[model samples]
Target: MILSAPSKSADAPIPSFDQIPCPILVTDSAGVVQSLNQDLLLLIGSDKERWLTKSMELMFPMASRIFLHTHVWPMIFRDGQVREIRLQLLDSGGNSLPVFVNCQKTSQEGIDRFTWVLFVTIERSRFEQALLESRQRTENISTALTKSEAFIRGVFEATSEGIMVTDSDATIISVNPAFAKLTGYSQEEVIGQNARILKSDRHDADFFLATFEILQKNKIWNGEVWSQRKDGSIFLGQLSISAICDQNDVVLQYVVLCSDITERWDREQLIHQMALHDGLTGLPNRTLLMERLGQIIAKSQRDSRQIALMFLDLDGFKKVNDTLGHSIGDEVLKTVATRLSSLLRNTDTVARLGGDEFVLLLDNPENSEAMAQIGARVISIMNEPMQFDNAEAHIGVSIGIAVFKDRTSSPEALLKRADEAMYAAKAAGKNVYRFAE
Candidate 1:
């Protein structure tokens, strides 16, 4: 009937403390080590005999020892526990290791003692610093992007050329002030509208389709286009369209820039006409006549057909210019050109070389008889009287015809042959036709 009966049951297993992975310690109230696990002895490169009965400050750096005395120990005594307290420890080789420590204060045998668990944190500190630096770098990039967008917006607002931005579907998203001025529409009126709002009837469906096809392939289209203003007035502008793509090369937007170029284009047309046509009668001058002659000669050679090149000079043009003044002479010349052009086929061309000399081109002439009939009709038309203001003026024409069969004759040689034949007609009584042999 004694306690010896309870002890006779079985042998209970002893718990193994060395199996714990991290460094663990037992310290008295004064932070003097009473016991340490084998893991801590191995971690600090020290034996248990060297640490027993020694102050735990032996394992801490000078700064961490001061912090332990000043902050960690006081907090542990007051709170009875401390958690995740960061500190540094000195190893046997004097290398400092960052660590996180957790401690619990307990009463054993009426005395205060502490159980400490420590974790190495050098690699974790490095990882935390890397995360902080990554966050800072992302912030810096965001700031830079904001500044870049501000710069782009300033340029968009200040540029002189009209700019319009659209989505991939060609719906307008933004318009600059210059674009509003050019199109007579305010920004509020244009946003969300399709670019077709500015479309003029000048461009057909085929034209737009071809243009868009080229733009899709090349990502740019620059040309003169007819556009309409908000007031329904049509105008010409030099349009430049560009595609905007994302990092993956997907089309995100379209940008249209335009400048009014109508006046400049009209001036260019005027200069072109002045260069190729006579100033008085508005007939094709020598430059244009030669170009037409070369093209017709090529066509006649390809078709194995004939083309007639006629050279004519007014019979008494110099007499009229001297007697009735050059003003009336100009009127007579205009009348002669009109009559000659009216009587010929639409495929024919009549051009003035200068002064009172004229040339005509007729493609696909039938025969000599047909040629003679045309030549006689031109002479008869020229012989008619022309009313020049108050008085009437009469002028006759002497014609020379040069027939081109193939590409064998050059344009200059052909014109020269016609010139020589014209003089022959003037020699043969001054009012008839002569054919170049």
Candidate 2:
């Protein structure tokens, strides 16, 4: 039978098998004795060597041995465990000892083993009858407790989310099967290791300090954590940690649960990118362009430096769309975006404001001459023919320059000035540039 001991306080240490308060025996599947705990050894009045490698039949009287062969072994083989069987054992002096036996079968390292817990019964026949009656009354409650414990153990083993239990000092005590699978580390490998072995070095000391501080204050912490596996791959985990405390509110252990969230995180980032970028050209949209312009303006004002904003309207794009269809026109726009992005410095910003309208924010351009040179380069590149499928398309761009020198100018006002200048450039000619008045 699988039995759960009494619930221990959080601060209490787990007792060793030999330190247990009851007599316990362990044997292989064939009833060959493997080990006996101290209490069992004392009850039998024998040393460890006497029982080692011996068949359990040697410890029992003839009647009990027959009962074990006929009833107990069959029950254990059929049910994997048995509870509350009355049995008689032989002590060193050849006296019969009556006991209540509970046994469970378990597999470890591919070998089946049986563990037995024995409770001594009173020798008087009247007392034994009374004790059996009392046991019958509590049997239902005991069975319920055992089933509940077994159900909990089943869940722990079967859950997909990783679970780990550690002492207050962050020493790993136990890890569930999911934890082993997720980390690529077996239970035996991580049992005594510090939990930091999973650290990915992505978070700083301050990050952990803040996490613990919040956990201390609230008794629980939940957040995203990046951890490394035994194979050295990093995974993002949505993690929660709870402190187990004693009656005096002293922490003794920590329970950590985690689920991999890397895919969810990547999806969120994709959604955010879609929100701020153009669908067609993958360039910054108007909203992102304006936000970047505002930041650059603020920085330029603080440093007493000049910044430039260029407005571009494609010259023959509508004609190409009208004749060659929107697909080829889209190809031409994407090609233009790539060329424009390649020509600019990494610090400069190039954005598409929908349709054939584009904008550029240049940080601390040396002078209007340098701005004109960039505008000329843009016009020259846009004039080149773009090949798409079996057709070729030609497009040109009219450019307008707006210089930001006054700290008082806002992003909207600067954009308006550049827009007006773009109209001026279109009025002068289709493929030329103009400065804002």
Clashes of 2: 1
Pairs of residues at least 3 apart in sequence or in different chains that clash in candidate 1: none
The 10-residue segment of model 1 with minimum total lDDT is: 1-10
Candidate 1: global Cα-lDDT?
A: 0.88
Clashes of each: 0, 1
Model 2 scores a C-alpha lDDT of 0.90
List residue ranges in candidate 1 displaced over 4 A: 1-19, 25-37, 48-82, 103-116, 215-225, 235-252, 255-264, 302-306, 319-339, 342-345, 365-370, 380-395
Q: Candidate 1 residues 1-437, lDDT tens each?
A: 11123444369443355656778888988999988887778778867888999999889999999999999999998999999999997877888888999999988579888988889888998998899999999999999989999998998999989999999999999999999999999999999999999999999999899889988888899998999999999889899999998887678999999999888988999999999999999989999999988898887766777788899999999988888998888889889888988988888888999989999988788987898898898899888888867878888999998887547888888898888889999999988999998
Can you give the lDDT of residue 415 in candidate 1? 90
